[model samples]
Target: MTDSTIWWVLAGLVVGAELLTGTFYLLMVSAGLIGAAIAAHLGVSLPFQIAVAALLGGGLSVALRFYRKAAAAKNPLSKTDGNLDVGARVMVDAWATDGTAQVKYRGANWVAMPVTGETPTPGMHQIEEVVGSRLLIKKL
Candidate 1:
């Protein structure tokens, strides 16, 4: 197939991978492939086409990373519903330091932790945040 055809197929593959994974990685690369296609169509050589694709893709990925970071930094909890129990109350059943901790929240046993200014004891605890299936808790 022609260079353009190959580039188009690559772009399609990138988009497909992005769709399947719901990640921005391949999507950005696919956009770079589109740019490469443009260059190829403009009579650029294979090396130039490949270089452009790599440069554009890498540049976009880095820029997007920084952009996302900046945006997130600007609004540290703008989109979260605070689902991590940022400021909720619960009851601690055990202490979880470097591993796992159990707690009771809404009559449900959940993993929790003690906040920096509070202590972790049985009974009531205020959930400061959630740490990936575990909760960062403090005394209520």
Candidate 2:
């Protein structure tokens, strides 16, 4: 098959794989492969086409990583985006001396603690992040 056609096919496969895996990084790589296909269509040398793919794929992945990090920094709890309990309310009956509480969340006992720079008080709290078995909670 022609070089440009091959590149386009590869890009399509990468896109399909990204869909199955649900990872954003693979989409970035697919974009790069598309760039390489364009270069091939323009009659660029094989080495130059490869360079274009590597540069676009790697550069886009790195950029996406940085962007995600920045977004997490702006909102610390953003890292827990995949957790279903995040932002869900739980009842804290009491707080212990160590600033943790035996709270009932999701119909079970959970060890809940406060987020950074907050005093743990007994009342209603929201799940901020789940680290292991412990729930980092925010007083609401």
Candidate 3:
């Protein structure tokens, strides 16, 4: 087969693999293959075709990495309860002198501490954050 035909076939395979893996990296490489195919169709030399493909794929991958990093930094994942326990109601039977109490949560006793609003009395409270084995709570 011709070089351009091979490049197009390779690009199609990479794109198909990317679909199965759900990753954009393979798609970036596929874009490079497509660029190489275009160069080959334009009668470019074999080395120039390879260079075009490598530059397009590698540049896209690096650019995507930086974009992903910046996006993650802009919207960081919150580790507080991971949205599983936070905002859940917990019954605080009593509070100790230090504003901490033993509360049953998720079928187990957990150390609960007040982090916002009024100090928790013997009543229901909302879990604001889960710090280690302790639950940071606030008045409901």
lDDT agreement of model 2 with the native: 0.92
TM-score against native, each model:
0.62, 0.62, 0.72
Query: Which clashing pairs does model 3 show?
Result: none
lDDT of 1 by residue, 30-97 (tens): 98999999898898999999999999998999999999999978877742355755677765566657
lDDT of 2 by residue, 35-78 (tens): 99999999999999999999999999999999999997887745
What's the best-to-worst order under lDDT? Answer: 2, 3, 1
Whole-model Cα lDDT per candidate? 0.78, 0.92, 0.91
Worst 10-residue lDDT window for candidate 3 reads: 75-84
Model 3 bad stretches (over 4 Å): 81-84, 88-91, 95-120, 131-135
Kindly give the number of clashing pairs for every candidate. 3, 0, 0
Alpha-carbon error at 101 in model 1, in Å?
18
Q: Please give the distance, in angstroms, between residue 99's alpha carbon in candidate 1 and its true position after superposition.
A: 23
